[model samples]
Target: MGLLDNMKARIGPAKEKVSHLAQRHGGTIGHGLERAAKLVDEKTKGKYSDKIQAGTGKAKEAMDRLAHRSGRSPEKGEAPQAGETPRSASPPSSPEGPPPVS
Candidate 1:
């Protein structure tokens, strides 16, 4: 096998295991990320507040994607209430008018 293939084979199982664990504890992981970000922002005396917020948001988004890949995503607005069929993950259709003129 090629070098890249060999490396992927070795890493694939570990990645799958990590993904499984992430799916199971995604909420906790997300909370931990938020907590850390808050602590860092406080330590910096609010100097990097905006950057920290953006970083935290990106981290949460990545976690959600990982959880979703393992079929454990619990995203709000993506869940169906009792007696309702689960909706696809597709974005809702936009109500904005047609594309603007060139």
Candidate 2:
């Protein structure tokens, strides 16, 4: 087989293994991401707040995907108990108007 094909064969299992690992340890991984983001934001004195926020969001998304792939719900079936906003109650940003024409 060609080098490229050989490499792909070798790496395929590794990729799946990593995905499984991510799913199994998704909670811990997500917690670590949050802690790291907090530390970085504190260290930067909130100077890079926007970038830090974006990174945290992306990390959460990755964790969600991993969790879902492993047959876990993003949120356990706890209804909007106490002071929680339901997903549908939130105001639409562009309810009446089309998106901006760019």
Candidate 3:
């Protein structure tokens, strides 16, 4: 087998173990991430608030995907949660189409 395939085979069990752990303790892990982000934001006096929030959100999303909770996955077709914009959503298009040439 190829090197990458061999590596994946070896890593498969570890990935499963991590997924189980994430599924079991996802809530606690997410809470910890939020707490740490809040602390860091306070320390920085909100200078990096936006970036910190974005990082925390992405981390939580990753954890959720790892846990595979609620059948949410790219392969399964994810539905956005309330108040969330879907990641693949495009910006609204102009009804008028392209701007008129000068």
Candidate 4:
């Protein structure tokens, strides 16, 4: 097998194990992520606020996926809502149409 293939083969089991752990302890993991993000933001005085927010969002998304609680279906285009905007609606448009055809 190629090096990449061999590496993947070895890491597959570890990934599965991590998924299981995340599922079992997702709440704790999510809390830890929030706490860590808050501490980091405080330490940096919000200079990296955008990056910290993005990372926290990604971490929560991963935790949700691992816990199977994201409410997104592979076959469905819309995310399940708890005060979230629906995916079917277009975002707000400008009054002008198509920029006067260039």
Candidate 5:
């Protein structure tokens, strides 16, 4: 197999393992990510706070994808609870046309 294919083959199992762990302990992982980011920010005295925040957001997004929701919707950066259906991206309907003057 090509190098890329070979690498993927080797990494497949590891990826599955990580995804499972993320699914099971997503919340804990998220909390750890947040705490780590906070500590790093404090140590840097907010010098790279923006970069840190961006990186942290990306990490949480990755964790969410790894968690693999089924039925209920999980909050951002969190795993779905047991027996919960995956939450749909349902938006509230716009009632009527325009809002009355308040």
Candidate 6:
């Protein structure tokens, strides 16, 4: 087998273990994330409130994905809630390509 395949095989069990743990403690993990974010926001006096909030949201979504939570993800053939966008959706691509960097 190729080196990458061998590595994947070795990591498979660990990934499964982590997934199981995340599923079991997902709620606690989410609470901890919220608490940490709140403390950081307080410490920063809300200077970076928007960035912090965005990061926290992304992190929580990632955790939900790892735990295989159904509520956070739209199942096949299911429609997302009003005002909610699925993670799989991306912004419209610009035919002009990326904007120039300053």
Quick one: best lDDT, which candidate? 3
Give per-model TM-scores.
Answer: 0.65, 0.59, 0.68, 0.57, 0.59, 0.67
The TM-score between candidate 4 and the true structure equals 0.57
lDDT of 3 by residue, 1-102 (tens): 999999978887778888889999999999999999999999999999999999999889878777874333243357755435677778997878788889
Off by over 4 Å in 3: 69-102
Task: Name model 2 segments beyond 4 Å from true.
Answer: 66-102
Determine the C-alpha RMSD for candidate 1 after optimal superposition of all C-alphas. 9.2
Off by over 4 Å in 5: 69-102
Candidate 5 — which pairs collide?
71-85, 71-86, 72-84, 72-85, 72-86, 72-87, 73-86, 73-87
By lDDT: ranked, best first: 3, 5, 6, 1, 4, 2
Residue 101 deviation, candidate 6, in Å?
29
lDDT for 45 (candidate 4):
100
Between candidates 2 and 6, name the one with more favorable lDDT: 6
Candidate 4 per-residue lDDT, tens place, 32-88, comes to 998999999999999998999899988787666655643323345756434345556
Report lDDT per candidate. 0.77, 0.72, 0.81, 0.75, 0.79, 0.79
Clashes of 1: 0
RMSD of each: 9.2, 11.0, 6.4, 8.1, 10.4, 7.7
Global lDDT for candidate 6? 0.79
Candidate 5, 78: how far from true, in Å? 24
The weakest ten consecutive residues by lDDT in model 2 span 72-81
**Cα lDDT for residue 40, model 6?**
100
Model 2 misses residue 88 by how many Å?
A: 35
lDDT per residue, candidate 6, 55-99, as tens digits? 999887777666774323367667765445775777997778787
- Cα miss at 42, model 3 (Å)? 0.8
